[model samples]
Target: MVPSDFKALIQRFYQLQSERIETYRLFEEGHEAYLRTGPHYDFEHYKQLVHEITQAFSGISKEVLEIKGRLRELDQADLCEHIEKLQSKEKQKLELTAKLQLAKQQAQDHPEDEGCLEGIQEIKHEIIKNKEALSEIMQDFKYDSEECD
Candidate 1:
């Protein structure tokens, strides 16, 4: 059978997935380093990480959305839906992370208070859960591409 024209889109989607995974790992490391409980809690480093992650997130989200609609047009509605779900989760994570950054910035003014890290772990856990679900979706995407062969 001839290869499907949509195979390139699928490969691009995988690239987005990989980029997100790399960014998320960096985020997790930054988060750990920013916590007061950690020995290397540098406010400046955390701030830089937040900025980097935000930029990365924006880029990935833009591409994911573009691919999402394109996938739908290519008659891959199921794959589109899966990506949309992941997109939604990623948006939620980004929003919560922004809020966390704001809280941390304020906490910097009051180092005596230890409430800054309150919900950080919760948000991280939520992201991990969503990520696992999205990984399964990616597996489905891989199988879906088999039709292209």
Candidate 2:
């Protein structure tokens, strides 16, 4: 039987992928909405949105690297460190994903105030990219595990 932790990790990866796709869909919605809003909204809001999206993208890219590290065969200390980083990064991604979704919802609910819609789009795009990268990492992990068996 597979270790519980490893199995759970694989499940979590797939779930993250699904969520990432959903984020992309939401982002498309945000882009269309932004076009509809025209220039009535403050440009500062768009800039802020881009900034937040950039942060989320950076955070997810970092997490993908951590996950790749965790998949490597390493000593106990290194494994522990990588696992910790993976957990931390996962938590951060979840938090940012929730924040992005909330921002998108708020924008949709209040079309008059695009607020953070631009940031939402950025988050969605980042999620799509990161999700693919993470999935590849997970596949590599699986293959490595199988090779060892």
Per-prediction TM-score, please? 0.67, 0.42
- Against the true structure, what is every candidate's RMSD? 4.4, 9.9
Model 2, CA-based lDDT: 0.55
* Candidate 1 accuracy as TM-score: 0.67
Error of 1 at 88 (Å): 1.7
RMSD after Cα superposition, model 1: 4.4
| Residue 80 CA displacement from its true place in model 1, Å | 1.3
lDDT of 2 at 129: 68
lDDT of 1 by residue, 1-149 (tens): 43365777777878987898799788877775677544445778777888998899889889988988887777777778778777876777667666665566556656677665665456557767766776777777677666545
lDDT of 2 by residue, 5-118 (tens): 554544554554455555546545554565456547444655565566556546555654554454442322443343444445455565666677567657766778755677
Question: What residue pairs are clashing in model 1?
Answer: none
Please give the TM-score that candidate 2 achieves against the real structure.
0.42
lDDT of 2 at 139: 61
* Clash number by candidate, in order: 0, 0
